[model samples]
Target: MIKLTKLAVLCSLIALPTQALARDVNDLGVDVQAATSAYIVKNTNPRYPGSYNGSRLEGWALMSYVVDTQGKAKDIEVIMASDTRGSEENAEKYLTNLEFAPATKEGKTVEGGYLFSFEVGKYFNGYSNDKASRGFINEYDEINKLLQAKEFKKAELALAELYKDHTKNTSEQALFAWLKSQYYYHQQQWFGFDEQLSVAYLLRAKLPTDIQYLVAKSALQWYSFKGDFNLAYNAIYALDNIEGKEFSEENKLATIKQIDDLLARTPQINSQINVSKDKLSYLSLSRGSIKIEGASDVSKLQIRCADQVVDLEASELVNYVIDEQSRRCGLLVKSANPAEIKVKQTGYAIVNSKFDAS
Candidate 1:
């Protein structure tokens, strides 16, 4: 598979209108806020998830329209669009003769220019690639609309369908991977660790060198999230080897700093797979004291402390310790939300609290 470099990520995400339609921001006669509802409709089908050359190619287009007092579209413009000049000219021709119900402001008909951004794309909905020529952006919008209308299952079904089918085109595929990874990560799907790693590794392979840093960064993110310091460190070092030759010293240092931060918090992380953990949980002034409970049978527990809920995590347990020089320490223990404590065979008791008591 061709490694789709991240450099073209933005391009891949957006469908280029056949022609460029951006204008000087000053030429937008009205403030963006005022033209909220105004839009110029087009006759062409917005490409979304569907068979183009007999294979699904996911895409979408966005355009803005200036409306007149007569409820007529005075101008049709593509915003942040990519396409040929001929397509743009055709879009303009379609807009010039377009009709719209005039708008009213302060009880009077007023020439109002509004920007309308319309999109259509594929969704996870059971709609197959053969059914819709678009992908995620369109599907996402429709699902959102349904959700906004309070149709949750319908929206979910759309997503389910998209996931089942077009889970390959970089866009559609990425969405599925993201949702699955998040689900497994949150559930601490330790069994799926290698699969998750494979996806991150694959993404790293696909992204271009210019944006390979992002891939490496993502890998580090998974490593840290999984509390696998060793793996995270290895990934960081590997990235350093690959990127060191090309990136400036300052850039490399910045990346290293991020990795260092991740490493600094390793000790507080639970080594056992069955434990539910909170490195930092929030509290309010209305409550004092926290209770800690075990997520499962464990012999150790830990929590990082802070002056406030500013920075809390299971790892870096010492951070919760009150500084001797400080007169008052923020409260760490709470009543209803006591940090449920737990421990593994290591016999660690970790809990973090911030206090500022005089």
Candidate 2:
């Protein structure tokens, strides 16, 4: 006896031309009229079972139906459901009775199939109240409070403890990874932060939409800070593809603007060394390697350390080392042309170098 608690049908007009409409209903082709303007006309709160055995089962059920030219819903079908007991049946029944104002295309009545996703769960402001879920929620809140208070060490300790407990739930695991990433970020552990954030981003499909957006946003910032233009570009691409009724139009637009701004400032890491005459050049290194293209005219590349000087050939790719003792070193590039040589450093700060070799 599961009581349906809240039911909301988010109708998005998938604009398709009349000519593209498939004659066969089984084709899975969308035949919706392009609306000049669309709006949510109804929101229903249905009753659902609160919990089962101290744990709440939360999932989404999708129902597809066509709004006829007469403004009546017809040909209702349950496309997918997480729960088969009654959620799918109820969604189908509810959608069959739902009505909508007829959609229009070029000022003519047209039938359109719309997808309705029913969020089935214990909705306490979009949070579950299941015992296990509640435990995690409470722990997260506690950690969040500590973080807000700038108790970073305490937060880290708490997070470490939380991570020790094994949980098979995908969403919970994602949440934990996200929190760990944030903690590392606050600690200024950039490598750990980036690694953990990547894990969260990959597991985003299992997370809630809001959490997914957060993960993407955080990844964008991390990649930008690391000067990883490629990763930043990928993050923006992910943000662009994220679309749903759960996200507000304003927020989505704001995120797009944020991505644009980040892209504008991101450096193009082509991994090429451009050397000019008598000018010291600096480049950020990735994995202790610098690939210098168009260096055929160069004669010699010399790296000067406190103890020794290592000379390298003017090849397509070069590798250098920066040990703890020789962190700050000098580089001298001698080329046939008055070249400006670029050396990529694989650390936070660029090593001191002098390009005095003529």
Candidate 3:
């Protein structure tokens, strides 16, 4: 695997916001979603390696990056790829020479991020489309129109309804995630935007490439900020046994290093969740374990992942350690009295980090 000597993701965005930031879009009274988006000004694909000039082996690489005010690409992530031999390295090298037309907001150049996907000798045009149901499509169109009309309240109601019923298929879920994320973005509600964006990220393979880009770009910020290295990487590696799924992380070296850096810079989480009989408390972890500070005060604890849940009896003290398998997982603390729960990163996350770039 080829490695960058040093990498700082998304320019200076590594220190992710905990949703209480002042530098977010809300500081500027402008509609970010309606603002002009960035575009490539100079995109020259890297030359095929001479060693594989006539070889049958080929691959593709997809990167997620931001265009700074000066139109320079920074904080790049090798978000997806195919078996593209050494094409992943070439894609990283291409960043030095690539440029973009900076996006404009409120008549001034502003920073925005996007995707760049390329393929080599082997073109997998069979990359299939994962479509939503007709009912979902119609409702999606209506919700989009409402958002465009700036009917925020109606759009929120529609999104709530859609969320309740979008579970019929992965594609429908992805579409709903993308739409709701855009809704929060327009209002500069960063907290809601990234939280819902993380949903689209989990079902990334079901989303179109463009939607994947938007989801990934925002994910780099939200997940990294929360110190959820395991969950963040797991979301990007969400490809299942689905046939015709084009994106593969066979070349995870680049993205792994990027996430490592983001996670390293994100402040460690040593927080508490107080639970009561009347309400259940939820705690999201980036990488760490959970312990009940006063187990005697708790009645039940639900250790939750994206798809599974493990219930623990809280009659005694409880300590649950998190590892690579604990992905996109959270904890639901239940207590008859007010119980103090502590969550912190015990060690860095490592599941399949030993990837071969060759």
Candidate 4:
């Protein structure tokens, strides 16, 4: 069977309009200004099975047909299908009954190909009696049961087999990783737990919206517990990007508060500094003159401001006087301990360069 990548499918869909009313086929092309100008007055979606061996299966199918001069679809064929058990057949049957406005070229009816894509998932309610889908669902249920029963060892074994069986399914892979993370947490295997949870977190986008939030929240908890503030901060950042009705209003407020609390506990960099791509850190002195102190040896320190580069030796306090007209200053510290560099503007602000430690 020929397999079409998602990119290829998208490109084909995009190119359909141009080919639908090719100038060569008809001099005036379709009477409609756009290929999609002809509208479908009546349409029906394919019916999906309620249960595929006691479990719901979801996927997509692509069908193509020609809208004849009579505004009726004919010669429907399935071009591709994620699952062919009944998706292709159902889609073809539905397309045949679909009615569209007749496409006209030069004021006369003309035939044009139409592509229809069907998504079979939660939207359709039915049961599939397919053997492979049923087998996969059963295995998933068995492992979930073991996990719920606290049979960690057995669940681990079952999960391994499940992974081996469905390596091609990204959603299933993420679910397995999440389950393994839970198993490790229950077993007090902290490192293993974090590792597995990290895998699941990175694969969160492949999961559903609700699952994405759950995985991100779990990651935030684990990172916070481990005192890895940087990773925790990142997890909070990821959570902020996820927005959906699945998350309640109260929950959203609580999440915002959690982010604020985390940020408050995080250390700040002294002096407002902007790090450039060239590896030079810049401090804007438009606010006021700032004093910098090196915690470690700073004999090779270089400071550049107003296009003037100055080499300074290690000292208890290095004062750089900035003219009111000077808006920016740059610092390049070369020391065994980069974390020792500190900057302060007396009575104004104290900024710590935690990024130097990273």
Candidate 5:
């Protein structure tokens, strides 16, 4: 799940009412989606050893970045590492040479911050026996490279090959799903939305509870890519519901509140939907306060727009949509002390358009 601060939401609110923030270093970009993308590139790419002539081995780096008002990354910390010895040192060395444009709001850079963790380098697993698996994994490595290089087609092809042949184990399946999700996200493609959702579900369902937080985070990414706001919410809920006996109560509450606040303030508004386009576009209403309760695993919620109600299963993210128009739909939700809704189904519920407000 994404961690947000009261100050961030407050900044988002102030930016919305007084003036529409330009896509500057302060506003954090659309739905915080673009912010995540930009942050991943900033933190991860530096971990890989630049090529001198030999192919680079693939691996993932888990690092946290503190993005300041200038949209520049500062004080990056390594939470975990997949790099061999000295990779962290090398990453730090590379990061020092980097600069970023801080996030801006209302034409001025606000001192807001965001953190991100991403895998860097090629995802190489030392040794394997099956040639098909090896080829597929290599292709997967190539796909990661394409992502790193901003190459989509070749990476997509490589992903297709992996999904088609080598994903039999849980880890392999997880890798395939993550790669596919990232690919579609980069191209703004939704061709495999449902498939990716299913893949995320399958992966999460099989993971142990201890690791559910990580799974929930990954599921949130899948839901966001698939444009399933409800699913994304449910994913956060799942994260919130975890027994935090091992953590301080203050930290647990803080974590849950951050997730809740994000959902409450950031409304996913449909800006454009074309039946022929195969993808959905939305303008995040990321500036209001729509209060929502923290969930406990399998909570249910219903969403209403216009006059229709759609049922969705709540976890951290819920998946629901309005399909009356099928092709195009304009949506908005009023957060002026909205009413609590009940969900009938186990996924997301789409409400009627009349329920939407500007």
Candidate 6:
């Protein structure tokens, strides 16, 4: 969590990538002119959920919806919600009444999809460690002490008890996920650390900007150090997004440089993960191509973008080479035994690749 302190809650719901990959517009087999992006024609503000009134809980909702040729938002999906109770419901209701200007291709209306995130209470600035239940605070403190003392056995028991005993609201879930990630990191459980930290990262969407920044920064440090280039890129991507918006151009470059420096000694990377059952791994790329390969256990590859989601069987990805122009994507692999997906970044950035660990 070094150097990125000022970035507070800009991106919401899910952590963002630098620039998402969009699909090629020419899906039509016949000749079609270049398509123009859809735009918002009208909007309606979402009403506050009644459950959130005066509650210490806070959260955000991320949705993906299709705008038909008539510019109506439909096929709505609540991608993520921090407060599961009503956050998704609010987003769905809001989108049901939303309007848009349909995208066009060759002067004719065409369908398009887009993602949107809405935050509740604009982040839970009212909630803090002091506001947590005494039981949670005591358990957290005791676990911290155990972790600090390298008493892994005790820390493990305490963490388990904390989860089962505590009423985990949004804030507590994020905090507990981070503490669990620390436990994994200390035990040198790289994959566990990555997955748990990612949970912590996403769960903080409605916490606080400063908290979000620290989580993102921690992710960047850990992923780069472990040679998990795919996620490290995501961390830096989200960080750059915040910095680019909040700081001046020069300052943005400086802040990004601080991140780039973290990966300076890293070698070129091909990220992979092993799974014994169903698993999904987010894939990101900025300037190069990627070829995804794995055991036949990979049942499908799903690449989702602002406008579309594409699914491919494992057979289809064997020789696939994703170039600079391709959008960022992810793979959903299923297996009866241990199978893996290898994401090889066969490109380089003089200032891009982070740690040499991969």
Model 2 vs. true fold: TM: 0.38
Residue 204 alpha-carbon offset, candidate 4, angstroms: 0.7
List per-prediction Cα lDDT, in the order shown: 0.36, 0.47, 0.51, 0.47, 0.37, 0.52
Cα lDDT tens digits, model 5, 103-186, are 334445433332222222322357421122465568777788899899777776777666656654344544566567667767
lDDT-best of 4 and 5: 4
User: Could you tell which candidate, 3 or 6, scores higher by TM-score?
Assistant: 6
Candidate 3 per-residue C-alpha lDDT over 60-117 given as tens digits, one digit per residue, 9 for 90 to 100: 4445445677877665555434333455665566654666667665577866544344
Q: Which is the leading candidate under TM-score? A: 6
Please state the error at residue 242 of candidate 2 in Å. 3.3
lDDT score of residue 295 within candidate 5: 23
Candidate 2 residue-wise lDDT, 103-163, digit = tens: 5546766555444554433435565432236667678878888877889989988887675
Instruction: Tell me which residue pairs clash in candidate 6.
Output: 8-209, 9-209, 21-327, 263-354, 266-355, 266-356, 267-356
Q: For each candidate, how many residue pairs have backbone atoms clashing (under 3 Å)?
A: 66, 16, 5, 13, 50, 7
Query: Which segments of candidate 2 are over 4 A away from where they belong?
Result: 1-132, 243-358
Q: How far out, in Å, is residue 188 in model 6?
A: 1.2
* Cα deviation of 290, candidate 4, in Å: 22
- Name the TM-score of candidate 4: 0.37
Best by lDDT: 6
TM-scores for every candidate against the unseen true structure: 0.29, 0.38, 0.44, 0.37, 0.33, 0.62
* Candidate 1 lDDT tens digits, 1-358: 2111111101001123532222111212222343322333432433332334543433222333445666566434333221212334544554454555454444455444333322223244465432322565566557556655756557557767766554544334434444444344444664443343334343332333543555456666765575443334445544664543354557656655665665454444432222223212211111122223332222222221111112233332323332222211112221222234322211121211111100
Candidate 6 or 2, higher lDDT: 6
Per-residue error at 188 for model 2, in Å?
2.3
